[model samples]
Every structure is written in structure tokens, then in C-alpha cells.
Target: MTGATTLFTGRITRRSMSGLIIAVLLVTPLEAFAYDNPIVTGTVPLRAGLLLLILLGLRTTRITAVEAGQLFLAQALLSMATWSVLLDFDPNRIAVQTLAYGTILPVCTLLIAPKATRRRWAFLVFCVTLYPAVVRLTPENLGLLAQVIATLLVHGASVAALDTHADRAELAGEMADIDPLTGLLNRRAALNELARGVDRSADDQRSAAIVLLDLDHFKQLNDTLGHEAGDDTLRHVAHVLAAFVRPTDHVCRWGGEEFLVVLPDADEALAIDMAERLRLRLVDVGVTASFGVAEVEAADTVTSWVRRADDAMYVAKHEGRNTVHVARRTDRLTVERPGALGAP
Candidate 1:
């Protein structure tokens, strides 16, 4: 495996082990919870063990933002389940734990540097879970609720702050390659994505499609609605395009309000059809886009392929604001450029 892959694996495994430890050392002890009346005299260990395994499973896999959200939600749910097992049927414990856990999610996401896997989200949730159970002396710790909540929030807020810092740190290196307002991949990212698409197509022997889209009368929208609104409009359009794209496909905010869509395994005809679909789809959003699409030639260079698509997009703009044009390049590796090499 590559060094990067090995590093990712190491990180994931480390997190998984930590989660296992938490389940064993901390949560398990809580099973003999109520001093005289054990929360789950026999089943406590079993529940903790199950949670450990599940946490391990999640930490071992690749993570995504959506999964992160679900993990936090799941952790809050699990905390409630754990509370049910406690001998004390204190609604406050259940309410405080569940509500606090829920409230802490966005804060957790904002604070924590994402784990290399989906498990990080779970970790944050687990943290919130452990807090109320540990902090609240008993169900009726009413007077202490404010203090406890304050401490937890402080901790959670700290995590959110840390996460924000980490996200900014990660963004620093790639900031030059992403659109500032919309956070879409920029021109540089598009170039890198183009090379990646071609490599995948060559390896898999599949067709790759490229589409260049430019918003119609985008300036007018800015003029009419204001730049802030224009920015929101741009973000909305990005969400739409992102929804349309497959995970295997690449979509970049090419420049300004223009976008580059790369569809791997799609031929010229297929590329054009998808481009047309984009054109029509934009109407629903009260904005229009023009598209220029191309298929990866046998040995096409980035310049050659992109120039054709770029030209086609203008052609579409000339014919009509919302339309598609198709083009094809016959050569690859025809230009000298940075990061253009086809081999490692």
C-alpha cells in the first residue's frame, strides 16, 4: 500500500482502539451504576461490548460528512438506551443526556478534526453521552444543572473551535483550488480532476465525459439581487450540480459562476445528453446554464480537451443562454504542463 494509505489505516485503527477502550473502561463500569442496585447486573458488559464492536466497525471504514451526522445522532440515541438500563428511571438523566447530546452535535462537528473514518463523529457523540452520566450526581441535581450544562458546553464549544481550526488548516493548502464563497473545486482542481478521470478511464477502459457550464445572466442576478444574494444563488446552483453528479464524476467551480463537469465512462453522445439535461434542469432553479461537453480522446491533453469544451460552452451561450455543445479532441499528452504526466 502507499504511504498515505498506510497513514490513513494507522489513524483509523488507533481511533478504533480508543473507542474499544472507552467502552470497556468507562461505560462498562457504569453498568454497576446505582451503588446498591446495579444498572444491568448482567447485561451491562454485553451492551458495552456491542457498542465497542459497532464503534470499531465504523472507525475502520472510510468516512463521509453524511455518515458523520448519522454517527452523532446514533450516539445520542445509544446514550438514551444506556440510561434506560440504569436503575434510576430519572427522566432528568434521560432528558438531560439526550437533549445535551443532541445539542452538542453541531458543536462537535465544528470542533473536532474529522477522524480519518466516520468514527470521529461517533467519538464526539460518545463524549457528550459520558458527560451527563458522569457530571450529574443524580436525577434531581436541579441546582447543579446549570453548572453541569455550562461545563459540558464549554467542553463542546472547545471541540467546535478546534474543529473549525482544523478545517481551516486543511483548507489552507487547497484554498487556492476552491471557489471562496461556494467551496466548489476551482480551476486547479478541475485540471487535477481531468487527469484523474483520464487515468481511471484508461485503467478501467471506460468512456469519460467532460462538460463546461456557464451561468446565464449571472451578472444580472447580482445586479438585481445584490452580491450577497448572488453568492447564495451560486451556492444553491452548486448544490444542484453536486446532486446531479455521481460520486465517480467530478464537478468544479471552473471560474466565477462557470463550472466544469467531468463524467467518467461517458462518450461524446452521452456527454452531450447529460449536458442538455443540465441545461434543462437549471430552468427549474430559476437560473439557466450553458454547457460544452467533450469525450476524452485516445491521447488527449488537458489543454486540448478543455479548449474544445471551453469553446463549445461559448457556442452554447451564443446559440442560447441555456443549451449544450459537444466537441472531441484526437490527441492526448500533446502539451507540456505541470501535473500533466500520465505515470507515477
Candidate 2:
């Protein structure tokens, strides 16, 4: 729904900007004739043709919104400069142009710098829009001074409004991806990330693995200790998993008391070793978790890959809990218990 709304809004914005440009093109010739300025009249054909070409390019080419806005803004600024020169820098006309761009340019700057460089670009645009009015400022035309103040206020307001909106949108997206209880990636977000990781692993011919951990006796803990203690245990387990994993790894609450940890660039051996370490760490926190480790295979889908790890986890639970089991590519199982030979 959000994607559809964004697409619809983009179409509307494109059409509106196109319509505005065409309207300006249609009006330029009328203004040239009405003013009867020799230079304006003489250059009408050339200027109109240039604008029409730009509009045509906007329609025929694939360009981002920022690029399109920039083309239109460049044309508008050029036309304003041309008219001012043709009219001998008429103070009234310059003031009008300054006011018009003071509004238009800042909006375009919003499109141009939607991210980190927004303030820098806005500052530059505000100075550029203010240049003409500054040169025309005098005691007699102190209204130009008023125009400067208005431009500054408008520019500042635009930046503040956009920053607030962007921040909220970002926060909302993060919240959507997070688990409410554990503050880890929820099942849905984890699956999406796993899919991407699988694709990357296939493309790069690198190894990737998933460790599925299930807290032992979690239901009994909830029933006996009450739900609050269960929730605390879940949060504590999530923190330990997060702290134990490498920076490239992903820790997710895979529903209920099950957690999935994605390990990129790791083989079966590494996966089992990591799982063993995680089991020991959970024990340190006075919690015991059954772990299953499965390295990704060439023909494995995300579902099948996670299923293999999950199957291995159950094997650990069956082997008297608090142990790690590895899923080999051939679907063979190696039950690894703590203190076993070749075990960490």
C-alpha cells in the first residue's frame, strides 16, 4: 500500500510539474507581446523552442524527480536572467523574479537534496535566490530587504518541515522491522534479509549459514514464573545472541522462543563452532538453549535452508537439550554434545 501510494504521488507530481512548465511556455510569448520589449519579442521564438525541447526531453526520457526539477529550474533561472538583461535590470521586474524564485527554488532544493546534503544545498540555493535582491537593496526599496527576510524564513521552514517528516518515516520503518519484546529483527524482516543473503551467497559463491536456537522449557518458565519473567528471559537471550555474533551476522526473534542467527561467509564447521560458543554463553546467563546449525547449499531456498537448521535444532532438543547439531549437505546429521571429541 505504501509503495502504491508513493507511485501514485510520483505520477501526480510529474504531471503537475509538466503542466506548470507547459503553462509557462505558453505564457512567455504572450508576455513578450504584451510588454512590447524589442529584445523580449525578438528572442521569444528561441526561448520558447528551448523550453519546448526541455519539456519534450522530460516526457521522452527516464529521469529522476530531482533531475527533472533541476532542468526546469535551470531554464527558469536562465529566462529570468535574460529578461532582466533585456529590460535593463528594471528594479520592479528584478524584485518580482527574486520573489518568484524564492518560492520555486527552495521547493526544487527539497527534491534535489532529500538526504544528508540537504542543508548545504539549501544554504547555497537561498544565497543564489537572494543575490539579485541584495544588489537592488536601498533605503528607497527597503521592501527588497523584506523580500530577503521572507526568503530566509521560507527556506528555513522548508528544511525543518522536511527533516521532521523524514525522521518520522525512518523511525516508523525501523519499528516495523523490530520485535516489540526483544528489540531484535522480527520473523518477517528476518526472512527478507535471509532471502537477500542467500541470493548474494549464490552470486558470490560464498558460504552462509543459519543457527536456530530454541530456549529449553520456555513454556514451563512462562507458566510457573509468569509471563513477565519469560519476557525478561527472552530479552536477555536476545542481548546475548546479539553480543556474541559477528558484525556481519543478523540476529532475529523467529517467533515464540525461537531465534534465528544468519552467518555469512561461514561453513558448516564454523557454524557448529559458533553455535557451541552461543550455547556456552547462554549457559553463563543461567539459560540453556538447543541449537541447530545448517550451512546453505547451492540449490536451497530460504525456507528449505531454515527448515534444515530447524530440524537440526530439534535433534539437539532430542539429544537431551543444551547441545548443537549440524545439518550436512547430504541431509546427514551429526549430533554434537558438549565435551564431545573435537567439540569446543
CA lDDT of every candidate: 0.63, 0.76
lDDT of 2 by residue, 169-235 (tens): 9679879999999989899889987897688678767788889999988888998899999999999
Considering only N, C-alpha and C atoms within 3 Å, which residue pairs clash in candidate 1?
A: 111-159, 111-160, 111-163, 207-265, 207-266, 299-331, 299-332, 300-331, 300-332
| Candidate number of the best TM-score | 2
Clash counts for the predictions, in order: 9, 0
Instruction: Report per-prediction Cα RMSD to one decimal.
Output: 11.5, 10.7
Residue range 26-116, candidate 1, lDDT tens digits: 7457535643344455655665665565555555534433343345345546645565555464645454554555455544343333446
lDDT of the structure predicted as candidate 2? 0.76
How far does residue 339 in candidate 2 sit from its true spot (Å)? Answer: 28
Least lDDT summed over 10 consecutive residues: which range in candidate 1?
1-10
Best by lDDT: 2
Model 2, stretches more than 4 Å misplaced?
1-163, 332-344
